[model samples]
Target: MQDCRILITRPEPENTLTCERLNTHGWSAVPLPMMEIFPLKDTNKKAVIRAQIFDIDTFDYVIFVSKNAARLACDWLDECWPMLPANVHWIGIGQGTTQTLLNEGVPALSNPGHTTETLLDWLKPARMRDQKILIIRGEGGRPELGNKLEERGAKVSYLSLYERKKPQYSAQTFFMLPDINLIWITSGESLLNLSEYVSLHKPEWKVLPVLTPSIRVAQQAKKMGWINASCANGADDNSMIKATEFHIGKQND
Candidate 1:
């Protein structure tokens, strides 16, 4: 772990936390955030999101797609709603998101895997028919979850609180790309952004090993010509550490 240099591709504060965690565990973690998160600045869109927060109690199921979503939604909820509805069931897509919801004083349930499919699977045994579900996420994210839920007889609504955009980086940052031992991408979008960066700056480094949180991301990496892409159990600190260990172990063998 000491010799391993991992490139973390998560957004700002989360990337810092992941780097610190990896460094504490004796690995060299580089902060190379591929995307940046920004609050919804458009007046009309902002008003819509706030309206959703005020009427959150109308939904039976409230789903948070990521830690950012949970945190941002909670901020609005705190300002608009004095108390969260007791009957609304909170569902977080992964452990990190679930923990964020819990920290915000919201009880939540999360699946073992970080993928949307896993969340769908976890909810399959429950009654979804005619239930109202509200999804809070960043702008322009996948509609698969909401669509699938709707197909299962649920009324789904979306509240987009933030926006995700590729970070603007200097050419010098790409110079260090070649020395990276492994690249850790948390989402498919990040993986695509990393691939674009590599293709434009250092095409040869595209062959470097990559660790992702879901099979969808791993598949995206492979489609982009990354030969050594593997998926971790989920998108959390422990899962990243475990994936890093597994990659290193395989290399040593």
Candidate 2:
């Protein structure tokens, strides 16, 4: 064992899953979740989501952006839809989202890649014209998907199911773990939050190797002037581990 510590900054539940997989591979996982997810508490938004649930069959398409979105949205949908409305195309952005939706009884398909841009690439402007699409996501998520659909003549509505906030951590939080030599982040938000936390504690960590889920995120890290940011191509356990091994071997060589 190299005795290296791999930082996992994915939000909870997924954070635990990723950590377990890392431990099995002989890398110590630092499970400091950078963001905490909470369902929307505003009365108006809640009412709006409830209304959408009641009229779920009216939409031509629905998209789940994250596993949390799938879980929260389906939890609300369960009361109204005993069976999913037929003819509505359900799409989840990532494999993680697809699997979570499948677990929560929402049948969702992921065409190929996992980002919003990838989905837009698969969608034809002709197919979107006059279609009604509902995008379920965290509060203040990226608007490109909905905006692009609307521009293509599809009527798009956003269902903000939850919000993500950075979790509070004490200095003692870092005491138990060894030096963090590697970090794995799946999103730009996670990178931002984790960097803030690391700067507060270990500013020198700016030079530590980082593993991003996609090339876009890796470029984001680079634009921020971080060193050694590598793309793992996915957020799944196998993909993360494979990329981690490659980086570690490369470092040793």
| Local accuracy by lDDT, each model | 0.88, 0.84
- The residue ranges of model 2 lying beyond 4 angstroms of the native Cα positions read none
Model 2 weakest 10-residue run by lDDT: 170-179
* Candidate with the greatest TM-score versus the true structure: 1
Cand. 1 Cα-lDDT: 0.88
lDDT of 1 by residue, 1-253 (tens): 4679998999978999999988989898889999999989899998898878888998999999999999888889889978878989999999999999999998998886788999999889989999999999999999999999999999999998899999987778787554888888899889888888888887877788888888888888888899988899688888889888887887788
Segments in model 1 whose C-alpha atoms lie over 4 Å from true places: 176-178
lDDT of 2 by residue, 132-165 (tens): 9999899899999999999999999888889999
Best by lDDT: 1
